[model samples]
Structures are given as structure tokens and as C-alpha cells.
Target: MSERTKTRRTRGVLGGRSERVVLEVLGATVAELAESGYRAFRMDAVSATAAVNKTTIYRRWPGKALLVGAAVEWMRTFVHDVPLPDTGSLERDLIDAFRRRLGIKERVEGRAWARLLAEKNDPEVDSIIGAAVEERSGAWYAMVTRAVARGELPDGTDPRLLLGMLGAIVDAWNAKSPGRLKADLLEAAVRTVVAGARSGSLVRSPRRRPAPRAG
Candidate 1:
């Protein structure tokens, strides 16, 4: 098979007129939501982005909620099915993982998910986000599993906790410096996380309750 065919197969993109229309509209929905957020999302913009008329979008989606819901489901698949990288060294693996995730977050496709994280109230969106987060956690866990198998990390290391810490570090840096990528800082952060994991600092510690208040 050609490289393009292999890529599409890996991504699970189906072929059909109906499928094409749905995919186009949903993709446009993601881009529109990412660019304008929920309150500001416009059907006309989605229509323009998809190059399909507004009538076609409405015919399939019926309304914005349905359209966005479908878009969220598409994202769940796209985000969850991402293949993990195994670079032998935990630090290099993590750095590559972080770059892929952050690159997606800064792109039109990933912006939909970023907005989804910030979106609130709507039961449909809330449910989708909850399920997606849990499912996506497996991706992070798989990375840690590989590292552990390779003896890069100790037994019982917690992948979710490690990923959360790394995510926090990235969020803080992005907040201060925006889109700029400082390779030194990224390398330091990955090294720090690897060190912590190796030293058992990132293990899943038991929850502790506060001491009972004195009478």
C-alpha cells in the first residue's frame, strides 16, 4: 500500500459519500469551536470551513448541540487512538510524547479538545469529556508501562500522576511564555520527571485523611 493509504488506514478513515460529508462537517465543527469557543461558534463558519452549504450541515446535525456532540465523539477517537512513541530512554520518550500532545493542543484539531476541557454545564459535553479523559489516560499509562518493562522506572510507578505533573509544568510555562518552546526548559522538565519517577517520587501514594479536629 502507498504511504497515504497506510496513514488513512491507521487513522481509520472510512470511504463513502455519506461518511465523507459527516467527516467534513464534523471536522469543520471542531475547527470552528476551537477558534471561537462554544458561545461564539457559528454555523456559517463551519459551513465555510467544510466548503459545504449550511443546509447540508443542518440536515445531518439538526442543530449546534448535535453537531458539537458528534465532533466531541470524533475527538475521543482521534485522541485516544494516537500511537505511542518508544525511544528506549524514558526521558526522550516523554519529551516526544509531550511535543505531540502540546503540538495538538496548539492546532485547530486539538483546540476542540482544549475548549472541551474548559466547557461547562452541558450534560452531553460533560459526559463526553469525562469518558474521554478516562480513556485517554490509558495512553499515558502505556508509556509508563513500557518504561517500567525496560527497567527505566521502578515497579508501582504511577503513570497518571507523572503525566499530571508534567502537564502542570507545561501549563505553567505556556501561561507565562505562550507558544515559545525553550528546548532547555523542556529537556530539564523531562529530566526532572524521569528522576522523580526513578526515585519513586511519582509513585501513587496512599491518600491520607486530616487528623480529626479536637473537641
Candidate 2:
């Protein structure tokens, strides 16, 4: 290969490695945030944990929320598309999907996510968190919708509501224990949702609007 081609290939390899470094830094930052709340989060701590320069983190994310947001987005993307196995049964699919999703969630990012959700007040934080939730839940929601379309689930099955409940279950567990997400809880919650869905008991009931108070 010519010198120019060799240089281009070297750059390509370094670029890929840089991407991994950025991801690792983000993950480390999230873990640090969980350990020390936002008030005490420091760039040096993140740099030390990730073993990267502070400049690298700053270049990728200008602020703490932005860095944390990217980390959440990364974790969400990891769980976005689980390989769907058609085992000729809704139960099997749900179990596999639930395991795959929970496996990722129980890792480092999930612990940090739980901490962030508990302290979510800022609009920017809320937006980032909401997007991650939606992205992570998207595939499972699609699977459920497909089941409904195929008449495997009830005609009134609401993927949104089901997924909301599923997320709530995981979030609750995480809140109880910040360090770890329990696999048993995940399995139980998934089974309950899937069974309710199959039996037509988990339909989304319309919310009751508050009655007007007499002035």
C-alpha cells in the first residue's frame, strides 16, 4: 500500500479505538456520578476512573448532564434490538427479551440510571432520561404489538402501557438497591406482564380526569 493509503488505514483504526475510549469514559463518569451525586461530580474523578485525559471528556460532553445523557443513550442503544427468537410461543419470546434487556440494565449504566431518575428535576435531564427509556423499550414494545396484530394478544393490548409497567418494575427494584438490579425481580415482573397480556387483563384503562371543584 502507498504511504497515503497506509496513513488513512491507521487513522481509521485509531478512530475506532477513540470511539471505544469515549464510551468507556462515559460509563466511568456515570458510575462516578452514582457514587457521588451531581454536586460532587468532578472531571478529574471521571478522568481517573476512565484512565483518559480530562480534555477528551470535555471534548465529547461539555457538561455533566450532557456526559451522563450520552452514557444513558449508549446503554439504551445496547438494549434496543435484542435478537428475537420465534419459539412459537409468546412466553418464550418474552423471557428471552426480558433477560436480554435486564442483563444490560443490571450492568453499570443501570445503577447510575436509577440514581439519576431519583433526582430528575431539570428539564434537560428529564428529556435525556425519557429518550433513553423510550429507546430501550422500543423493541419489546414492537414485539408486543406484533403479537397483538397476530391475534396472539388481545385486540386492545397497549404496548405503551405494558412497557411502562415493565420499566416501573425495574426502576422500583433499582431504587431499592442502587448497586445491583435483581434478576429474580426482573423475571417475575416479565412473567406477570406477559401473562396479564396474554389473558387480556393488562389493558390500558383511560385515566379519569379530575372533577372540577365548585368555586
Candidate 3:
């Protein structure tokens, strides 16, 4: 292909038929990545799975890393379309978000995420996962900001920390326990964090003054 053709493909100015072909290839790329993982993923496999010629994939994505990165981006956009709930309660909103995440874990996309997480040693895969986390965490940030605005959390509260704490708790429970997560447990954890944040207990205070040294 000429430089102009490559540029047009890269810029996504291709016609509708070509666009559909790219989408199909991306879908197959995701599936192939999930099944074979980054270490064993092959372009020929993706081409066969997508029912398109290998040249087509190469035209759109010049390399394996680029294709896998694009596949991860596609999955992120496809999976996270729904907005987080706004129920006038931060705890409830968090619970809903966690539940939704659990639901995702039961789907094919969830399997893909798990596979990606296991292969996070790969630079491209790691970058993709990091970007996906940042994108998904936007909703949590919004929820926390709303809580602050509503007086549920104190001003200057760190939304990222709060979200991280919740994620840690949920992840631990999911890994250590063999069954479904308990609603009460999730609620209690959220309540504890919120209570601490609200009462100023979780906030880090400045270093206390040292008394003058005795002569």
C-alpha cells in the first residue's frame, strides 16, 4: 500500500465498508487476546477469526501492540456506557458500582480484563489496563465530588483515596471468599470509610510541634 493509503487508514477516513471490516477485526482481536493472552497472541489467528485477510489488519494496526491497544480501547468504550447511579447517597452509589463490576466479572469482557491483569508485565497491556482504570474511576470521582457538595463528605476529601479504599476492600473480599459478595459487608465497609471521612478521623493532620530541648 502507498503512504497515502496507509495515512487514510490510520486517520479512519475509510468508507463504511472498510470501517465495518476494521470493527470486525477489532472484535476478533479482543477475543483472541482473551483466549491466547498477550504472550501467545498471533496476527494470523486474528485474521482467520475476523474472516479478513492479514493485510487488512496490518493496514489498520501496524503491529501487535497497536492492535492489542486498540482492542483494549474498544472494549473500554463498549463496556462502560452506562452512567453510575445517583441515589442521593454515596454509599448506595458505591454499592451499585461494585455490584455492576461483579456482574462484569461474569461476562466475556470480564474474562478479558482478568487475562489482561494477569499479563500486566507486558508494557502495552499494562498501559492499556492503566488507561482503562483511569477511565472507569471517573465515575467514582464524580460520585465522591457529589457527596462533598451534598455535605456527606468533608471539603478537600480525597476522592481517589476513597475509591481506592473501596476497591481494595472489594478485591480482598472477592479473592479471599469463595462465593458472592455480601451486600451487608459492602455497605458496612462504605459506611466505615464515610463515617471516618465525615468525622475527620481519616484526614491526615500536620506534624505536631516539638517541645524545646531541655538544656
- Among the numbered candidates, top TM-score falls to 1
Looking at candidate 2, what is the lDDT of residue 74? 67
The true-versus-predicted C-alpha distance at residue 62 of model 2, in Å, is 2.5
**Full-model lDDT, candidate 2:** 0.70
TM-score of each: 0.74, 0.65, 0.72
TM-score of candidate 3 to 2 decimals = 0.72
lDDT of 1 at 1: 100
lDDT by residue for model 1 (81-114), tens = 7776877778887888887787787777777777
Which residue pairs show backbone clashes in model 3? Answer: none
Clashes of each: 0, 0, 0
Candidate 3: Cα lDDT at 183:
83
Clashing pairs in 1: none
Better of 1 and 3 by TM-score: 1
User: What overall lDDT, based on C-alpha atoms, would model 1 receive against the true structure?
Assistant: 0.78
Q: Per-residue alpha-carbon lDDT of model 3 for 67-103, expressed as tens digits?
A: 9888887887767656788999998888888888877
